[model samples]
Target: MARFRLLPDEQLARSPLRELWREFARQHSAMAGLALFLLFVVLAVLSPLLAPHDPYLQNDALLLIAPSWSEAGLVQYPFGTDDLGRDLLSRMLIGARYSFGIALITVLGALLTGLVLGSLAGMSKGLKSSALNHVLDLALTIPSLLLAIIIVAILGPGLINTIWAIMLALLPQFVHSVRNAIAEQLNLDYVIAYRLDGASNWQVLTRVILPNIWERLTVTASMALSTAILDIAALGFLGLGAQAPTAEWGAIIADSLDLIYVAPVGVALPGLLIFTCVLSVNLVGDGLRNAMKKRRDN
Candidate 1:
């Protein structure tokens, strides 16, 4: 006789991370996105070892040089030189760290700070909660990019300021999402049961609510990361971030705008890198949404 086996309850599983990994792996697109993201991380990590030339070093002879494959280009400069004659390939490899590293930090900062604010808002009552919600509504009315610009303008243009600007711009989204999700979950039967069983609000949140909403938070974080990365590049392009001689992708594009018509690839390649990274992240986020939906359906 064949024996029937039951899957372990997700929350009770000894290795919930392993279970999540299995769920995450169910989506091929997510796996692909992860692979692409990892490739960028690796390239950034190994840039010093792998890059043939100094990213910031200039050679007057290599001015406006084409990629190595082009007839006019030298074999040494595989991705050619920028307007300043610095190695584009090396710059690109180095720039990956800025986007990925800063965005990761921004997302984590926004998540933690927003989570604290959201939890407080979700638990609070009366006029103060209403006032806070209204503030969030007002904040959301402004475009995030515009909000970021305003913050950057006040803070003055620089690398650190850009990070703070992006983080501030992203906070409202996380705060709103967490607040709404927690509020909704609080009214659910399981949450009420926990309360009736003498669980404190904090315990219910930690033991019951957060575990269920973990997937939603992760998906949001993934989406937020892509936005942060794009914003970093955009601010860099606008001369309000990263500054001159920095190899940031957006700044790289800005540097080559004059030659866009004459050497289109120089401009196009950086844009493509941004596009690919953003798309990969969005796909992963979408996959997480799908996985969460599937889990709920089952």
Candidate 2:
């Protein structure tokens, strides 16, 4: 008699771990991209716990100080003080929250808007799909940075407006991806069978095509999240994102620019923080994409 046996958890089993290690080795390029990204996210999420001082409190006496190897020699300012005497280290920690927050919102908003529009376009063919695709393509043709600048200029520069601008810039990509995914799945036999069973287009989309396209949608959304963070950081750097008095990474770095010569550390510190955040997010996305691909291939 043959005995039933359970397979070990692949995530922990030695063979599976070996395969995972091999995957990492084979995809070192992607793994490196993801590792850098993860490091930044850990920094951002742990900012409050890790910050050395109250970022908002200012001491005019310490203004424009440069970073020093000895904590005591640096007047206890690890990353030095900004022009306003605000602790650069603290400001960087707080700035992480806003940059990460804006990116999250923008990506989620774009995903929701894109999925809905794309589903509609995919379900309805001929003129409807053509028109929607044309509009999305036109929007995509405009440089995202230029479009973001124009929108932010009109809407007034602020956190919410910046998020909106980023979303607007990203939504078209989602729309295109979703439309293609849905269009590809719509003709599958399962979908045709659902229609034969008297399901409406909406029902078919919601039950059949949508479910099938979900994996692609999720991957695209994850990728978009990473891009959104970078874009928001860029806007903040340009003085079009979180404004004065708000400790946004971009704003902090921008404010530190004038004092670059006086205290180069001031400029480098915030910039490094932003870079880490963006890098970590991209890493997580890369890891996720790779893991999913491996699963599908298996």
What's the TM-score of each model vs. the native? 0.92, 0.84
Off by over 4 Å in 1: 1-20
Q: Measured by TM-score, how close is model 2 to the native structure? A: 0.84
Task: Report the lDDT tens digits of candidate 1 across residue range 1-298.
Answer: 9986666664434465655566779889999988888887787678788878899998887787898899998898888887778888888888887877788889999999999998888888899899999999899898778899999999999999999999999999888989999999999998999899999988998999888777778988998999998999999888998887878888888888989987776788889889988988888888778766665565
Note the residue pairs that clash in candidate 1: none
- Candidate number of the best lDDT: 1
Model 2 CA deviation exceeding 4 Å by range: 1-3, 9-50, 68-72
lDDT per residue, candidate 2, 131-166, as tens digits? 988998899898777888888999998888998898
Instruction: Give the range where candidate 2 is weakest over 10 consecutive residues by summed lDDT.
Output: 8-17
